[model samples]
Each structure stands twice: as structure tokens, then as C-alpha cells.
Target: MMLRPFSKSGSFYKGNLHGHSSNSDGKFSVSEVIDAYKKRGYDFTCISDHLWIDNRFCAETVTDASKYNTHNFIAINSAELHTRGKKYDKENLWHLVANGLSKDFKPSNDEENIQDLIKRAKGDGAFISIAHPEWYSLTFDEAIMLKDCHSVEIYNHASTVKCNRGSGIYIADFLLNENVKTLLTSTDDSHSLEEDAYGGWVFVKTKELNEKKILKSLIKGDYYSSTGVVIYEVKLEKRLLKLKFSSSNNIMVSGAGHTNISSHGYNLTNAELDLENFDSPFFRITISNQFGKYAWTNPYWFNELDLD
Candidate 1:
């Protein structure tokens, strides 16, 4: 089935996958978050509350999935699996976003204990992502070892809340170490209602929007992370990664996904890199500013044979 074509006229859908509501610590209710994005011309959103996998709230809010699940606007359900944190009392939350899994899905913040939960969620065909690696001990070294992790968050809304120290800097650095295929996502880990924390989000390029198709695009890594900026398109070919910006502003793109990849400064509105390209497995991208603050895109895996 052909999904609704992405905004071909350069319009992009904005979504926050790691949002919280009164259900957790967020100030707004689910309805409030939806209304907020709708006002900003968002196509859809995922209410990935903390520690809960049940989307019954989503179903209840929309009432009719068919009507709301259209080309323009839709609501999806997801959860943020918690993990051990640096402090003994505070839990290190590792998010595992799932789609049609059983509502019984549970998240733990017990350091490595969340591994078992992630394995089970992936086994049941859920879309799982490692939350902010810059938070606790959830480093890229650990994420690389975890199997079936379809994606990782390059930037988190709450990252700034953690003194901007939780932005997945080290994770992006390690992406250059080995070729690991995984999608990258950005979420507004919102806990307050007064602020627009949904600053970081993904710009997906699918023609249609639905639970199935949206999740599929995410798993395939056909999305880009953004913070007040949008990547119109990204294509990696013949040891080159080409990126087009939606707006022509002085932008910076830097990150080490694979080894031996070096980048030249921006040539007008585009950035070019001769990074060691991977034909198969995952490759990563980082876009940022001179200030060292930026967003990370999930590794877009290239099939060995498809790299022609």
C-alpha cells in the first residue's frame, strides 16, 4: 500500500517520540501534547510515556484510529524503558519504544537489568531504541553489544535538562569505531507543560503515515534528527555522504560514524564528507554548530549489494 507521500513541497512532519505527560512527569495531558503539535503543523506524534507500554491512552484519546490515522495527523503509543542511573536513588532510564506489543511491557532502570527487558521487547517485534547514552553508564560501547536495537537517540530533549551533558556525544564518537546498523531518533523528553520541550524531533520521508508504516520507516533508519533545523534529504554513495538542508543557514555537520571518515567545511548550503562508507551494516551522522551542540541521525544501513 502506498502511504501518503511525504510533503513533497518541502513540508516536513515533526514528532517527539520521548514525550511525557501527567502520566509520568510531563505537565500536559496526552490531549494537550497532541493539540500543541497540531498547532505547529505536525503530521503525527508518539506518546512514549515513561515505563508504560500500554497505548490504551492513545486509543482513548483518538477514539477512532482510522479517522485520526490519516495522511496528515496520527497518534501512536510507545514506552521508555528505565535503566540504572549514576545515583543510587535515581533510576537510569533506557527507553525501548514499542508498537503493537502487549501492554504488559515493563521498563527497568536497574543498570544492565534492562537488557532482558529490551531482548523480550525486540523478540515480540517492537521498535526499541536506547535512550540518552550521555545520561548514566548507557554508553555506545554497551549499545553496540545489544542485539536487535533498531535505533538510538542522537539527541534528547531532557539531555539539555541534564545540563546538556546527556546529549549522546560519546555514542556518536564510537559510531566511527565499528559498522553497526541502527536508526537514530530525537525526542523531547518533556516533563514540564510550560515549556516547548519537543525541540528535537525526527523528519521522516514516507509517503503515507500509519502505525505500521511509521514504525517501518523508523526501523529502516529513513529519518533525520533535528533541533530548529531540518535535513531535506541524506544519501550515502561511493564513500560519500551528501546532505541537503531545508533552510540555507550557516549550519555545521560533524560526527564520526565509521573509522577514517573526514569532512570538509560547508560548501554553501550543503556539507560533504569522505567518511569510510559502509555498504552494509550501520553508519551514523552528526549535525551540529560551532558551539558543540547538535543532533545525531540513526545509522542508515546500506546493503552491501545495494551500494552500487
Candidate 2:
């Protein structure tokens, strides 16, 4: 069988899984955020504004962009959920992104913790994720604690452009190293209408353009995250992993604790790597385009994939 997104039978929907609007710290309003993404050829965008009961960097309610759903493009209900008790955060908040949330979802009260918030979000069937670990210096202990999350923001656009610290690769690697079994995601996390808006997104392999379908797909890891590069296909045939992607300067296979193999050249379109000799229990692909853009594949586990 095929691996995840490539294995799934569906159309690829281009969407930004994390973003902000004036409902929180973002510069644009909900309607404008939708319009901005739509004008830039996006199939969907989330208004995942900061949701917390505070005056500095959060709103009391999740920003609802559901009204902007057109037949072709759509919006998923989401928020950059926050709670207290984190180390090294200026605001002492733990940022989590909960997608496919209802309008009735409540923000964290003074008494509850991150686990409390995650429990509620999971109870509602929401897709939970750790947000921007690098930006806020999320530690290994904290990541292990948020084990309930489905994913971590492998890339945060605003965090990178603003402070030059937008990577969660270290946190993600730490999780994988611990056998946490989490997926990877990339987000714009756009709080402004500037270069932060279109920098990162996901191509979800969903059957239709419906919000529920998209969110379900995400939970199943039926997607690939990117920052401009594209993965056309990934398939395994007799222990040889084949990848078809956009023109790139490098195609690398990386795994647990620095195990990696790479191919580099000018505008290389595809690669055939032997996995039989690959030693890691899991492996992921990363492609770097000539312009320095990167696309990431969710890590694939060997035993779980049932390679026969």
C-alpha cells in the first residue's frame, strides 16, 4: 500500500492550518484574513486566533471564520489556545492550537491546566497541536507532557521572519526520539498581513472541500506540510522508496538521532532511495528547492506500515 497522504485517494486542498485576525493579536479582521488568503489562491485558511481570557495577546473567544466558507474555498474553526505554567515564556503561557473547534468551546480559566484544556478539545474531536516550540522555547519535558497533541508546528512562519527562531524540528525530533508518535505540521501563524501570511501551509488529501472532512484528514495524517515546495507522490515498492516532487536542489531522508542520506543536484525532480539498508525505525523526507523553500513528509514507521 501507499504511505499516508500519497496512499489516500482524495484531492489535495491547499490550506493554512494556523493564522490570526484582529480577534486577537493579528493585524487583520476575520473577513479580511479570509479575503487575503482567497486572493492569494489558497483553497482554505484558518483564523486560529489567540484564544485566552487576557488583555495582552488573546481573545476571550475563538475567532469564527465559518461564515466566509464559499463553495470552492473554506474555513476551519480553530484557535491558538493558551494556558499558564510554562517555563521561559514571557507571558507564561502554553500555546496550543486546537482545530475543528465549536463556537461554544471555552477558554482556559485560572484554575485549569493544559491537560484540562486538551481533554476538552479532544472530547470535542478537535485536532490538537503544540504551537511554535522554538519561538517560545518549549522544553523537552513540556513536549512530553503534551503527549496528547496530534502534532507539533514543525515550522512557524511568523516566528521565523520576526525573530529568526521559527523551527520546532528540535522539539519534533525530541518527541520522535521518545517514541511519541506525533505528526508534523507547518503553519503561517500569521498575525499580520505581511510576508507572514503565505509562508507555510499543508496540502490535505481530502475527499471534498468540507471543513469536517479536512479536519478528519488532518487527524489521520493524510497530508504533507510545505513552505513552497511540492510533493507530487511517495510510494514504496520492494523496500525502495520513490519520491516525486517539484524541482529541488536536495532530497534528504532523515530519521531518529541524525540518521540520514541525501541526494543533491540542480533541479532534481525525483529520487529512488533504498530503504532496505536504512537502519532507523522511522524515516521522513525533506526537500529543499533552489530558492531555499522546504517541504516535509510526516514520518513513516516501519512496523506500522506493514511492509511485506
Q: Which candidate should be chosen as best, given lDDT against the real structure?
A: 2
**RMSD in angstroms, all models?**
5.8, 1.0
Off by over 4 Å in 2: none
Residues 86-165, candidate 1: write the lDDT tens digits: 23224323455554344555444333555677777777666777677765556544666553666666677776665664
Clashing pairs in 2: none
Residue 257 C-alpha lDDT in model 2: 93
Q: Cα miss at 249, model 1 (Å)?
A: 6.5
